[model samples]
Target: MSRIPDLPGVISSDEIVASAEHLAGLQTDSGMIPWWPGGHCDAWNHVESAMALDVAGLHREAERAYEWLADIQRPDGSWHNYYLPDGDRDMAVEDDKVDTNVVAYIATGVWHHWKCTSDRSFVDNLWPTVERALDHVLSLRKDDGLVLWAVEADGTRRWDYALLTGSSSIQHALRCGAAVGLATGSPRPDWVDAADRMCSLIANEPLAFQPKTRWAMDWYYPVLTGAIEGEAAKIRLADGWPTFSMEGLGIRCVSDEPWITASETAEASLAYASIGEFATATDLLRWTRSHRCPDGSYLTGLVYPDKVVFPEGETSSYTAAAVVLAADAIAGASPGSDLFVRSSLRPS
Candidate 1:
């Protein structure tokens, strides 16, 4: 099977490589993948970009990106919310908090790389990091099984309320972490149970999470993370479609805005595909072509009506990563293609 993803007329393997290369180019020598040239690097998006590199057959670069994470991981297995290219905590944004979802995402990235390469040694090496990270995240899980969004840098201050988007993502990561553990001969049944609880909370206890109804991520992430699936997932998408999607454009960053974001649209495509709605998924992936830049990097978002690029010429590595992942989900081009769609509770 092809390691690289393609969408025929929509996007070619070469175009996917170009986008992956664009993300690789943005990587600092230390292997940290920032959002943009000088933008902050969040753990979640940084891992996402690394996964994209692996999807495009850039395994060496992807490994380096993971090494960056290993190098900077805190003692408690958590990473600060944002980092600079120079490898320092970014206190300027969100006061350098440690987001539970951000810390948990390393498991997803590491698992994706393992699926692409089948490298047991790599998974073995990273297993401890993944273990610690997920353990740290689960340590903060509330009685309802939903994790709080973030904690202070010192792990002293807490955010108190849970978030639907972040907790949903954590649910996915926990399962991925369990998968990684099983691969390394170290199964984590507790993590698996935690994931199931989080999934239940996400699927049944909407009020448990802080209200982020305006954000597009809040609308699609549960489905994207596989916390809600089957007919329920389809119905959720249909219910949110009118509010989040823009015909012939892309999904909005916020329901109340006309601004269309590439990453959000790409992720929504993956969510739709996970539920067997390939036609809707393919169309969503196609819509992201509008954000494609000449250099294969994706513009962050576009303001509708006039279709002006917002953030003034911003092209983010994470945006390109999302597009690459979405294409993989739709095309089933690689072993890792089903990473988002497959059940993380089982072996890949």
Candidate 2:
């Protein structure tokens, strides 16, 4: 079988060296991939870094990240957005997020690591953790098919409503859960319903989450899942492209005001590929990979600190997650695999 390669822009000798350097240089001593020296961690960032470690074949380092999540997961199957270097809580949100989606993200992480390394122990060990977390996340779903925004880390409720990004994110995670459920020999009807309900909200209703903003993440993610597919997705995607996209740089998390966002662009590129816009997707990925360091890590955002300023530094997790998902779509392993050039997931 002809397998896909790891890391985008990694072809020539120099590119290979750069990827190796980027991968090795990006690691922290604690084995938990930090976004930046003094930065906080979120579910998205953690999962992104773990996938990046998988791309680099740093399985142990990657496994540690999954463990980091397992250790810190709240009793109610969610994670706080921030954690201090000592593995203690740092900045706590006023209300805890019912991070069922993020909690379910580990299924993708474990599955990706298993495919890359074929490590059965890693997959088998986390079965219960995955099971219980999904159980709790599923507990909060509403009759209209919306999941709650979040709960307190201590299991208190956070909000009575749902956020668009949060709902979109969890929808993807629920699909990941289905995949995990299939893998573990214990599939749940609730998970399938969660995926189907989230899809219905995305496809059938406009007011699924918060009103649709021009954030590129919001634009393309529905396509990444089976939530929005085919030509309708293309229109929904292109409709918002001009508002936030720069021809070469990336996207802004929101439209109208604020600065551009690299993480959003990278992920949006993956979403674009889901709809088969290979040219646009690769261009964004190339611009992103071009900005990468010799060590294979990438800066988190662009136009930060101030909109006029250049991006600061490696949100290895962000870049890593983008790379993996984009690559997955490209390589045809992902549900929306029709997006990539080959089956490499590296659309560019």
Score each candidate by Cα lDDT: 0.88, 0.61
Tens-place lDDT digits, model 1, residues 199-309: 888888888989999999999999998899888988999999999999979899999989999999999999988887778888999999999988899999999899899
Index of the highest-lDDT prediction: 1
Query: Could you give candidate 2's per-residue lDDT for residues 1-348 as a string of tens digits?
Result: 213333345223344334433544544554444556544566556766676555545567778777766766666666665554553433334324445556666665665666666566777677666766767777877778887766666666666676666676676666666666666676766777777887778787877576667566667777765478778878887787788787666777677654655567677867776667767776666656544555555566566434353444435446645655565444443323332222443334
Task: Identify the runs in model 1 with alpha carbons over 4 angstroms from their true place.
Answer: 87-95, 343-348
Best by the TM-score measure: 1
Candidate 1 differs from the real structure by a C-alpha RMSD in angstroms, to one decimal, of 2.8
Those runs of model 2 whose alpha carbons end farther than 4 Å from true positions after fitting are 1-30, 87-98, 304-307, 310-316, 324-348
Worst 10 residues of 1 by lDDT: 86-95
